[model samples]
Target chain A: MISVSMTVNGKAVSAKIDPRTLLVQFLRENLLLTGTHVGCDTSQCGACVVHVDGKAIKSCTTLAATCDGASVVTIEGLAHDGVLHPMQEAFRENHGLQCGFCTPGMIMSAIDIVNRKGHDLDEHTIREELEGNICRCTGYHNIVKSVAAGAHAMAGSK
Target chain B: MYAFAYQRPTTVRQVQSALGKHEDAKILAGGQTLLPTMKQRLASPSAVIDLGHVAGLSGIEKKGRNIVIGAMARHAEVATSEVVREAIPALAALAGGIGDPAVRNRGTIGGSVANNDPSADYPAALLALGATIVTNKRKIAADDFFQGMFTTALEEGEIITKVSFPVPAKAAYVKFPNPASRYAMVGVFVSKKGSDVKVAVTGASNEGVFRAAGLEAALKGKFNPKAVEGVAVDGSNFIADIHGSADYRANLVSVMTKRAVTKALGK
Candidate 1:
């Protein structure tokens, strides 16, 4: 077993995990942070998206040991003191999800996109950026709206 | 995923030593492709060496007339690097268009080149720009690096440290992305180095990314989109898959090649 230590959701966390353990598995199984869902075992599904050192990455494809000493932020990190994050609020307000399996990752990825690209995102850019996250339901009409709204809200705050 | 010993080395020497110590070791660059393959039981290494912590393996630098890119640099990093954007804007756009935000953040150019997937985007750029693959052992020219479909000239245990691309006078990449997976169903890279013009096609050929000699010869005479108007590429060696037929992909090579030239010319 490899001993790994990293900051998760702004808190320092450590665990003794197998070298083969994926970051998603470590988050869900070891830390019980099941908010970061795993829809597909392949990297195609962004259901396991998280922020590693402030950049969005597919946790399913990231090894837990590779993130040793880095900072990670998952879906569980989005909420604060019973208030939903702006992206989460935007998703809820815009009806971005139907089944919600891809919500956590979608929100995480959208937040990261806003953090990087800011509020000038267009519908086409949102669609292209969200290609990594697959949603079987919704056909992406409302998801795009959610991202745009989130971007607007983010921009309004700054 | 099978159990393996994992080590994160912080320096190049330590990375090389770790690689030298383990016979059944795999260098983990971005883990975008390798981890997925491991999850599917396609590749089972006894030891996985993580190169993310290696300090010098993740930057973009301009040396003389070449753009030196660290192998471990993520697609997002390359896409956003001012040096890459200024020197090779098309490369930055290509990197920015790969996969999505998550994949771009995690996938490294080194891992993509090492894996050498037939449908990847980077090989087309490297081939067209006449990039040099710098490894721990020696530097291999892009022309001689890619051997065949999903194959490269990299010897076992030889790790790629960096890639240096010559500053092209003009360049662009055009790709028809797979709808679901977002990988290139067919992609073309067109570049002009001095007076010589090079055109490379990826994701459409069974032999992987290769120079389109017909297109090259045509463009050499006239470096414009109209140069490829009547060119016909032989589909005999093109890759035929569910996304497109060999003939269709062959036809797309011309179409994408034309579009790439137009884009490179900023038309």
Candidate 2:
């Protein structure tokens, strides 16, 4: 076992985990942050997307030991004092989900898109940037709309 | 993933020492490929050496007439780097088109180049640009670095430190990507520097990324889209997979090369 320390959801967390433990496994099993789902253990699926040191990366493929001393943010960290983040609010309002298995990852990846591409996202830009995240339900029309709305809302909130 | 010892080395010397100590150790660059393979139990090294903590292994800078990219520099970094964009916009564009945003955030150029995946974009760029792969032991030209699919000239215990790419007067890359995986079905990279012209083809060849000498000769004679029209592509040696037949890939090689030449002309 190796000692791993990282700031997760704005809280510093430390644990001794197996060297092979993936970040997704660490989050769900050790920390119990199950909002970050694992739709596909392979990196192809974006259900394990998370923010690491301000950049978005697939947690399913990242070893927890490699993320030592890093700052990680998951879907659970988006809200504050029972108020949903603008992106979350947009998803809820715009019906960006159906079965909700991939919602956490979609929301996490959407915020990353906004952070990288800015608040004014077009249809083409949103679709292109969302290549990583997979949505089996809702046909992505509503998710695309939610991302654009969330981007604008985030800008407005700031 | 099999149980293994993990070591995060802060210096290249330390990495070398660790590799020497563990015979079956694998150097972890970005974990974009290594981690996934491990998850499926495809690779089970005795030890995994993490290069993330290495101080001088990640950066992008212009050196003399070439762009020197550190081995650990992520695809996203190369894509967004202003220096890379200004020096070689085609390279930055290629970096941007690799995988997706999330994958780019963690995938490093060194990892991709060292792995030498037949469908990877960097090999074509490196071959077309005549880049040099710098390892701790020695510097190897791109032509001599890549051996075959999933093979490189890097010796055991050797680690890639950086890659230096000479800027070309004109360059472009065009890829016919597999829709689901986004890996190139047939990718062509074309470049013209002074009197020299290079055309590198990837993803279609079973021999791995190779220079299309016929296309290069045609483009050298006349640097135009029309020059590639008469160049014949033989599919006998190409890869035939479920994604595409060898003949289909051969045709795509021709079409992508033409498009690449046109794009290089900025038309």
Candidate 3:
């Protein structure tokens, strides 16, 4: 077992885990941060996506030990002071989800896209950037809208 | 994933020591490909060496006429780097199109090239640009670097430090990606440096990524898509998966080459 420590949603957390423990398994099992889903553990489905140092990544394929000193943000960390993050709000307003299994990862990935690509995201760019994320429901029409609204709202929130 | 000893070594020498200490060890650069394979139980190393803490292993900058990228530099860094964008927009675009936003954040150029997945994007760029693979042991040309599918000339314990890509006068990579997995089905990278031209194909060959001598000969000095229009590409050696037939991939090699040449010419 390896002792790993990381700041999760602004809280310092540490755990003794198996050397091969994935970050998604660590987050969901060890810390009980079930907000991060594991739709497909093969890294194909982005249901386990989260922010590591403010960038979106597939937690299922990453080792928990590799994030020893990193800061991780999950869907649970999106809201602050009883207020939802703009992206979450936009998802609600735009109905970006259906079965909701892909919401957390979708929202996390959307916010990171806004962080990097900025607020003026076009439909084509959002669709292209969303290639890694798989949404089995909604056919991505609403998700595209949510990302656009979220990008614009995020720009204002910041 | 099976049990293994995890070690995060901060230096090249430490990594060497870790490898020397464990006979069955695997180096983890970006974990893009390795982790997936591990999760599937296709790879089970006794020791998984993490190179994340290694110094001077992740960055992008211009060194002389080449763009020097640290091996550990993430795909996002290369995709969004101003230096890479300015030096070779084709390379930047190529990086930007790999996997997706999340995958790009974690995947690294060194990992991609080292793994040499048949469908990977970087090998085509490396081959066409004549990039130099800089390892802890020595600097090797791209021509001598790739041996075959999922194989490289890198000896055991030889860690890739950085890669230096000579700025091409113009280049572009065009691929028909598998819609779901995003792995290239048949991709072509076309580049020209002075009077010499190089064209490399990925995702279509059974022998893995390879240079297209016929297309290269056609576009040598002309640097035009029309130059390769008449060239014949054989289909027998191309990969024939469910995504495409060998003939179709061979056809894509020609189609993608033409498109790549047109993009390289900025048309």
Candidate 4:
């Protein structure tokens, strides 16, 4: 077992974990931060998307030990003072989810897109940027709309 | 993933020591491919050496006439790097189109080039640009570095430190990507350095990424899309899978080469 420490959602956390432990497994099982989903265990699915050191990466394929000393933010970290993040509110307002399994990852990835591409995201940009994310429900049409709205909302909130 | 001993080494010497200490040890650089392969149990090494803590192995700078990128430099960095964008915009654009934003954030140029996945985009860029692969032991030319499919000339325990790409006078890459995986089905990278012209093809070859001598000859004669339109590519040596047939890939090679030439010419 290896001792790993990292800041999760702004709190410092440390644990002794197996070398084989993935970041998603560490987040969901160890810390019980199940807000990050594992829709596809492979790296192709974006359901395991989370911010590590200010960039979005797939947690399922990321080893917890590799993330030592890094800062990770998940869907749980999006809200502040019991108020939903603008992106989260935009998803709810836009009806961006159906089964909701892919919601957390979608919202996280959307925020990442905003952070990189800015808040004025277009449909083509959102759709193109979401290539890593796979929505099995085939609800990409609404997902695109939510990301656009969320991008603008995030800008406004800032 | 199998149970293994993990070590985070901060220096090249430490990494070499770790490799020497453990049998069947694997160097982990970015985990974009290694972790997924391990999870599938396709690769189960006894020791996994993580290079995240390694210093002096992550940066991009213009050294002389070449762009030197550290082995640990992530794809996102290469794509967004002003130096890379200004020096060889084709390289930066190729980096930008790799995988996706999340994958780019974690994937590294060294990892991609070292792994030499046939469908990967960088190998084509390296081959066409005549990039140099700088290892801890020696520097290998791109032509000599890539051996075959998922194969490279890198010796065991010899880690890649950086890749140096000579800026081409004109260059562009055009890929016909597989719809599902976004991997290049038939990608062509075309470049011109003075009177010499190089055309590298990826994804469609059975032997992995390779230089297209016929297309190169055609381009050398006339650096235009029309020059490659007349050259016929053989499909027997190409990969034939459900994604595309050998004949279909052959056609794509022709079309992609033409398109790549046009893009390189900025037409």
3 or 4, greater by DockQ: 3
Give Cα distance to truth, residue A74, candidate 1, Å: 1.1
Model 3 clash tally, residue pairs: 0
Where does candidate 3 clash, by residue pair?
A: none
Greater-lDDT candidate between 2 and 3: 2
Candidates 1 and 2: which is better by DockQ? Answer: 2
**lDDT (Cα, tens digit) per residue for candidate 4, span A70-120:** 999999999999999998998888888888888888888899999899989
B256 Cα displacement, candidate 1 (Å): 0.7
Q: Which candidate wins on lDDT? A: 2
DockQ of each: 0.90, 0.91, 0.92, 0.91
Chain A TM-score of prediction number 4 = 0.98
lDDT per residue, candidate 2, B1-267, as tens digits? 899999999999999999999978999999999998988889999999999999889889999999999999999999999999998999999999999899999999999999999999999999999999999999999999989899999998899999999999999999999987889999999999999999999999998999999999998899999988968998999999888899999999999999999998999
Residue pairs in steric clash, candidate 1? none
Candidate 2, lDDT over the whole model: 0.94
The true-versus-predicted C-alpha distance at residue A69 of model 3, in Å, is 0.8
lDDT (C-alpha) at residue B183 in model 3: 90
lDDT by candidate, in order shown: 0.91, 0.94, 0.93, 0.93
Q: Considering only N, C-alpha and C atoms within 3 Å, which residue pairs clash in candidate 2?
A: none
Worst ten in a row by lDDT for model 3 chain A: A128-137
- Which candidate has the top score in DockQ? 3
